[model samples]
Structures are given as C-alpha cells and as structure tokens.
Target: MSAPSSRSPVIDTVKGLACMAIVWHHLAFYGPMSDIAQPLAPGLMAFLYDYARMAVQVFLVVGGYLAAASLAPAGTARFAHAGSAIGKRFVRLMVPCAVALVFTVVVSALVRTWMNHPSVPEAPTLAQLVANALMLQDLLGEDALSAGVWYVAIDFQLFSLSVLAWAWVRALPGRWPQQQRAALARGLIVAGAAASLWFFNRVAGLDMWALYFLGAYGLGMLAYWAVQSSRPHGWLAAIVLLGGVALALDFRGRIAVALVAALGLALAQRMQQTHSAGRTLPGWADGLARVGQMSYSVFLVHFGACLLVNAVVGTLWPASAPINALGMVLAFALSLVAGRWMYLRVEQHVPSWATALRWQAGLVGTGLLVALLSNGV
Candidate 1:
C-alpha cells in the first residue's frame, strides 16, 4: 500500500516551538514588560529581543516546502492555472488575517486608553487599513496594524514568485526529456535562491520585496525535493553547500539559522521515511502538530493578545517585573486560546460564499464578534 498522506509530527513540533518563541519574543522585546524584565535577566531578554525573530525562518522554510509539495510534487514545474492558485492562496491567508486586522484595530484603540507604550499601535487611518488589506503596507509605506504582518504579504509574494518561477521552467524552449526537465527545474530554483541569498538579500533597498527573502524560502523548497529524492544525502549536502557558500560570501546570522532549520527538516523527513513503521505517533508530538496547524492563527492573533494583557499590566503595575511577567504568561496563554478559537471560527470556518450577500454576512458576523469582545458588552 502507498504511504499515508498525513502530516509529520516533527514538522508540526518545529512550527509549534517556533510559535511559542515568537510570542515570547514579542512580549520580551516590546512594552514596559521588556524594560522591567530586562533588569532581571538582560542577557536572556536581549537574546529574545534580538534573535528570536529569526525563528520566522522556520516558517519560511516550511512554507516553501509545503508550496513545493503541493504545487510541484514530482520535482518539476507544473501549474495549470497560476491565477487560480494565487487566488486560493490569497483568500486562505486574507480571510483570517482580515479578521485579525479588525480585531487588532479595535483592541489597539482600547489599549491606547490604558497605556501609551511605543508597542501600542495608533488608530489606523483609512489608508493604513486599505494598504494592509491589500498586503501592500510595506510598499505603500503605511505602518502595519499588527506585528509580524509583513510576513503575510511576503508569504503571498513568495508563493506567487515561486509559481511563476516553476512555470517559467516548464515553458523553456525545448520539450526536454523527463529527467532533463526535472534537472532544469531544480537548477532554476537553485539559481533563483542563490541570487536571492548572495545578491538580493544583501541589498537594503530590496528588503521590502519578496526576492530578498526567497533565499531562505527556496532552501525549504530544495529541502522538500531533497527528501523526496532517491538520494536524500546528496540533496541535503547540496542544500548545505548552497547555504555555506552564501554565508561565506557574507555572514548573516539569520541565514545561518535558516540553513540549520532547513537541514533539520530534511533530516527529519529522512528519519520519518526510515523509521515510521506505524501510523500512530507520540502524544506530545501530535499535540505539538496541532499547534503547528494553528501556527498561522497564533501569529496573527498573538499581538492583540499581548496588547490587551500589557494594557492591563501597564494600567495596574506599569513598572513591576512580577506583574509584567505574569502579564507575559497570561498573554502567551490567552494567545493560544484565542488563536485556537480563531483557527476554528475564522480560518477554517471561513465561508465558501456563493454570493456577495454571504460574504457580507460573514464580515458582519466577524464585526459583531470583535465588537462584543472589545466592549464589556
């Protein structure tokens, strides 16, 4: 029988772990909590403040890996309707993100009444909301309504770019043989990734563009193909060499971390293939995988959760480390609770609106929920 098409617990564990760190990073890096907590353990807080964001590379790699697995599973460029693919991706990301944005805007307004930390976002202008809705906030120079939102736009750009890249490979002049086509496709992906890492990634002017982050994203794609290949080690080594060369040219700690994560994923896939004799997995692994599944929701909602908790702590005990630490714990716990609710209610339950009326109804429902949560009503 063919292998079961289930998610790997290892991947989910990585994602879940990253989600926790990201939540911690946000709380430790922003607000009066950071100022208070830093005095207790400056080194730890400093690490979280400076390097925890790099955990995003895990998601980047995972995104590319999944994109490749879905779009071009057999190691070749293959997409029939690029626009349709783009549209599906857009809706999948936007539905929940739009709801999260609305929630952020409302929560931000309420939190501003309690405290005025720099972490507290201002009331969004019409332009700001529209720009973020279009995922063009970075390009339009409008501030993001929530933390880590730029990644949502970047993920879309990377997916579109990757699809286009694969389509270009498939459309090359000659009708090459199967093996030749696969080789060509892999080569193009590598070239694009290398360009991003060695050139585009280094250019400060290009930071807002998807190309700048494609290097890490491409590594994830390469890793998926590598694990799926007959010779996993060879492909894994190639991925390592690509990352090594990029680092040798210009050392980037973020890229280095991404390289390691990509390697870990590749190795994990190989191990699963070799040792997964049974369908069942460890309980903790399964639990973490659920978190991985909810990671997008957590990323979208955690900032608002943080703001609410921080507002409470700030209002009651602005400079107290103990209270701030408690706030951080509550923020983390509440984010997971809220994120799970969001995943269930908004992300997955997003309506398959057959008409504009249905879509409007969904929006109205989301608005009502946000309003009720925002007010003590």
Candidate 2:
C-alpha cells in the first residue's frame, strides 16, 4: 500500500501485543520459574507454552508488509543499489542483535555456574560464537545463544530474498510497461509463497531457509498491495483463497495465524484510509504503539533478562508457587526495561558497517573470553 510515511497505529498495536505474547511464551516455555509457577495456573501456563509462540507468525507477516512498503510500494524495485540496500539492512538488524547476543552470552555464562537448568546455554566455542554473530548458527548446527535469535536471521534472509526478487524484475530486458513489470514482480512473490506453503514449509528440514516462511511473508506483501489497490476486495479475496487452499491442503496452525494477521492488516489499513481524520489514538494504544516501535529491542534482549530473573527466583524460592509467579512478572518488567534501554541506546541510532562489525567482534571476543575464564576456574 502507498501508506503515508507516518507510522500506523494499527501495525504498532499489533506488534506490541505480539511482542508481549512472545515474551510471555518464552517465560512459560523456559522453566525454573515457569515450572515452579505452573502449579498455581496450570491451564494458563500450558496455553502460553503451547499456543503463544504463534505470535511469531504475526511478526513474519508484518515484516513482509513493511518490506513491501519500503522496497516497492508500486510493485517495482524502488532502489537502484540492491547490494547496498541489502548490506544496510544487514547492518541495521545485526548491530543491535550483536549487542544483545553479547549480553545473552554473558548472562548465560553467569547463570551457568549456579543455575544448572536447561534454559542456560552452555559456554560457547569460538566457532559457535562466530556462527551466531554471522546469523548462521542454525545452518552451522550450533546452538542458539538466546531464544528467538533465529527470527533475526530469518528476517534478514526474507528481506534479502525480497530485495533480490525486485532487483531481478527491475533488470529484465526491453521496455516493458510499468504495469507488466509490477505484475511480474508480484507474480514472483506469489509463486514463492505458493512454493513455501505447499512444499518448503511442510518440510521441517527446510525451516532454516527463507523459502519455508515465504508463505506468511508473501501474504503480508500481498496484503500491502491489496490495501493500496482501488479494487482492494478482489486482492483481499485472492489472499484468502491462497491461504485457504494452503490450509486445506495441509492444516498448519502457524499458517492460519499468518493468514489472519495478513487479512487483519489489510482491513485495518483500509479502515484507516476511510477515516483519515480520526488519526489520534487513546493513551493506552499510544503506549502500545511505542512498545511496538521498540519491539525488536525487546525481542532481542528478553531471553537474557528472563534468564537472570529465573536464576535468582529459582534459587531463593524454589518451592513457592506464588513467589515464582511474581518472579515471572518481575522478569517481564525487567525485559521491558532492558528493551527500552536497548532501543534508546542502540536500535534508535542509525546503524553503520563499523558499528555492526565492532559489536559482532565484541560478541565473538566476549564469548571466547567467557569460555576461557570458565576453563581456568
């Protein structure tokens, strides 16, 4: 959609809510605190553990929507320098990611001594550290240094894939009509999404690649175009059909979540377009939007924050369900605080190659140092 440069309250609100879900999902999924607290609210813990992870589907769709908005609002490549754009995107994602990983590695090391829980990642090898810094840990068969870090890698891959697709369309020979060019570009996205939904996504082994998640991501791109089109209903219907057929063929709850999120985004944007005057949101919504704006920071740092809280709480009150429940709450609060700090100090700043490299080096260096110190001790 040809959205205004101004931020969308709807998108931000969705992100904020999804971010909260992910944080809570991790809290419930990774234990000690959740283990101790589950007796108090078994059903609630079970639901969070099982269902809340689907919130990531919302992020995938939103990521696609934003990628389309930035890369090709009119269905053609907007930027001339594909390589430069890809590089910039990498730096933008990894600078903050590296910083967060360093924190996570350090926290994991500190927690390893006293907390022999499965949630604490073991000491990193140099290879593992380097792989993680390069966002290749999954591909290299190394354990993730933190929860949800895989999303950061997948995000970069999806963005790069989208950029390359648009760049390919833009490079086609002959004076093709702009409409035809746009159609070709969109056709590629549709085909990729279909391949993902019908094939790659079904194969668990392919989860490390962008193709496996393109179904959700492509729905987001389509949703953006649908919102921009005069015949939005028709485009929206196509989205529904695509997702419906995929689900009918093979029912995946994550895919359904993605489909719903994409449709919700389209409908919300349409409503905003129809009522342009009432743009101001209520205070709570405004707060949510703020959280959404910084959601990436929260996502990056929360595992370490929650880990620290878990270690402390489990040590002091291992048998107290109420105390452990309160510890969960405290962990959530600390995650928010840590997220705000990261957003303000790191994410909000414009990223650079130097900054990204320095942070990456720091992550690897710190990880090696931790390993060495642990060995000496």
Candidate 3:
C-alpha cells in the first residue's frame, strides 16, 4: 500500500529548533562555552558551532525552493504583486524585532538604572530607525537592529534577487516553455550557489556582505524547481550541492551531518504528504504550521535573549570558559521559555486580541521600524 498520507510538522519543528540552536550557540560561544563547552564541553558543542547554523541554510534553501515552486506557477511577481509577499514578510519579521528591541531597551534601561552605568549606549535615534524600517540597517554596516535581523534581511534580499532572476529568465528566449526555463533556471541557480560560496570564502574572506542573498535562497529555488519539475529530483540534487559546498569550503563533518539531517527531515515531510503515511501526519502538520507561523518571531528574538542571558551570566558567574558554560545552560533554559512567551504574546497574540484590535499582526512592521529607530542600530 502507498504510505499513508501525512502532514509534515518536522519542518516547522525544525525551524523552531533551529532558532533555539542559534540561541544556545550565541549564549555558549559568547557567554560560557569558551570555558565550559570547550575542553569541558562535549564535541557536540563544537559540532553545532561548525554546522548547526548551516541547518539555517537548509531553511533558506527550502524557502527558496518553495518560493520558486510558487513562482513556477505564476512565473514571477511584478512590482505590484511583489508588494504583498514582501510586505507580509516584513510584518512577520518586524513584529518580533520590535518586541525584542523594546525588550532590549528595557533591559538596557534597567541596567543603567540599577548600575547607573553610563558605559552602556543609549537607544538608537529616529534616523537609524528609519533606516531599519526599510531593512537598510544591516546593509549600511549597522549592527543588527536587534540580534537576528540578518535572517530576515537576507531572505528579503534573496526574494528580491529571485524576482529579478525570474524576470531575466523570462526576457530570454523570451518564449521558452516552463520546463526548459525551469531547467535553465536550476542550472543557473547551482552555478550561482557555487559562485556565491567561492566568492565569499576566497574573495571576500567569508564576509557576509559579499555573499549573494539569491544564492542561498536560490538553493531552495533550485530544489523546489527540481522537486516540482518533470524529473522531480530533490534529494540527489541537495546531496550534490551540499557535497560541492563541502569539497569547496573544506567544511567539517558537522556541516555534512546537518545537511543530511535537514534533507532527511525535508524528505520525511514530503513523503508524509505524498505517501501512505499522509493520514498519520495531519496533527504534526497542524503543529508544524503553528511552529512555522511563529518562526519569524523566534528567529528575531532568540539571540537577544541569549545576549541578555549572557550578560547576566557573565556579571554573576565566573568569567572563565567553564563558568560561562554553566551560564549558557541557564541562558538556554531562560531563552527557550522567554522565546516561547514572546511568540505567544508579542508575536502570536490570541485570536481575540487580534480580532478585538482588528489588527492583522501588521502593526509589527511599523513597530519594528520604531524600535530600530529607537535603538542605535
């Protein structure tokens, strides 16, 4: 019998987990693990630093795939069509960002109040907020407006790039059928991904700026194109692409491991939908949908929580690596709880709150801009 049709909560759970991983990494790396997770810490800590964030690349790649798949149907978004997708993304990201910025400011403010320490910087100005409002903060050499603005900024930049690429493809042979166009697009995307990695490590010294937003997003686009195309070959292509990344970058084994884990999860989800397991997955699907829903918020706020926890831990615990490691554990516990709270309250308000205010979670777009303006950058 065909595998029961199933829904994939795995993806959503992965997103949620990835956010937590980032949180732990930041907390451990900056706060305690240097001493704690280092010699005292296990190899897993090292593995995460080396490879876990690459899992984030998986998210980006998948997003790119799904986006391209959607675009395959519509071809591409025009200026008008682009507005809503871009706008919604903006809202989703900015809301949690705003909340984090406010939370950070409050924390910063409290520190100043208690310590009377003039050493800490004040909140950012209106001009800075304006820049962040347009998602220009990161591009302008500003520190992340909060902590995780990179993900949103990069994703948006990639989305824009994808649209442009699609436009260019459309202009060429201007009448090629979708199949041929998709194949060409996939080839181009792979080439671009390779070029992106090469240029980043070799040319830009692995600087984030030199990397192509499209390349990362394009990875997903390419995958989606393959999975949805006549050949429908996602699994093998992902392995090949990741292999290229490994060989070219001299990636440690952790990255390869992350790639497999992520791909397996993606495939499992796909199988649940397409196979006989489909019925076994609706609950997971619904749950994942919820997790996916809160992903943007978690991504934005998790790091800041880490920072705060790191600071407090450093202030209270041993400054040495071992002591800092303890702090990281504490931070993880705190951030996990705090992250969930922010998602539930700040990012994921109840239906009543949403309906009562007649708000569509859209206010977060403006709110984040305000926080950015309020924070120094």
Quote the positional error of residue 276 for candidate 1 in Å.
Answer: 2.4
Ranked by TM-score, top first = 2, 1, 3
lDDT score at residue 292, model 3, on the 0-100 scale: 55
Residue-level lDDT of model 1, residues 1-377, one tens digit each, is 00114266777788888888888899887777767756777898888889898999888888888888888888675668777777767777777777787777778877877687889876555566667777899999999889988999999999988787777777778768878877877787788889998899989898789999999989998899888888777778878888999999999998998899999999888788888558666798777778877888999999998889888876788778877777788888999999999888877664342432343344445445544554546
Tens digit per residue, CA lDDT, model 2, 1-377 = 11124368899889989999999999999989999999999999999999999999999999999999899999999987899989988998998899999999999889888988988888999989999999999989998899998999999999999999999989999999999999999999998998898889999999999999999999999999999999898779878988998999999999999999999999999898899757698999988887888899999999999999999999999899999999999999999999999988988788789999999999999999999988885
| Candidate 2 residue runs with Cα over 4 Å from true position | 1-6
In candidate 1, position 185 carries an lDDT of 74
Instruction: Give me the runs in candidate 3 sitting further than 4 Å from their true place.
Output: 1-7, 32-51, 73-80, 112-128, 171-176, 205-213, 233-246, 249-266, 279-293, 311-327, 345-377
Report the C-alpha lDDT of model 3 over 1-377, residue by residue, as the tens digit: 00012113555665655655666555544533344446675686776566556556656655665566555543443334545555555555555565666565455544433332233335555545555555667667655546556666666666666665665676685577877775665566666666764454344333345254444555455544444445546535654675466456765443344455435554654565576753544575565455554565656665556656555655665446666777677666676567667767866542233342223233334444545655545
- Leading candidate by TM-score: 2
State in Å the error of residue 361, model 2. 0.6
CA lDDT scores, all candidates in order: 0.80, 0.92, 0.54
- What lDDT score is found at residue 325 in candidate 2? 100
TM-scores of the models, in the order given: 0.90, 0.97, 0.70
Q: Show pairs that collide, candidate 2.
A: 1-224
Best of the candidates, lDDT: 2
Model 1 CA RMSD to the hidden true structure, in angstroms: 4.2
Candidate 2 structure lDDT = 0.92
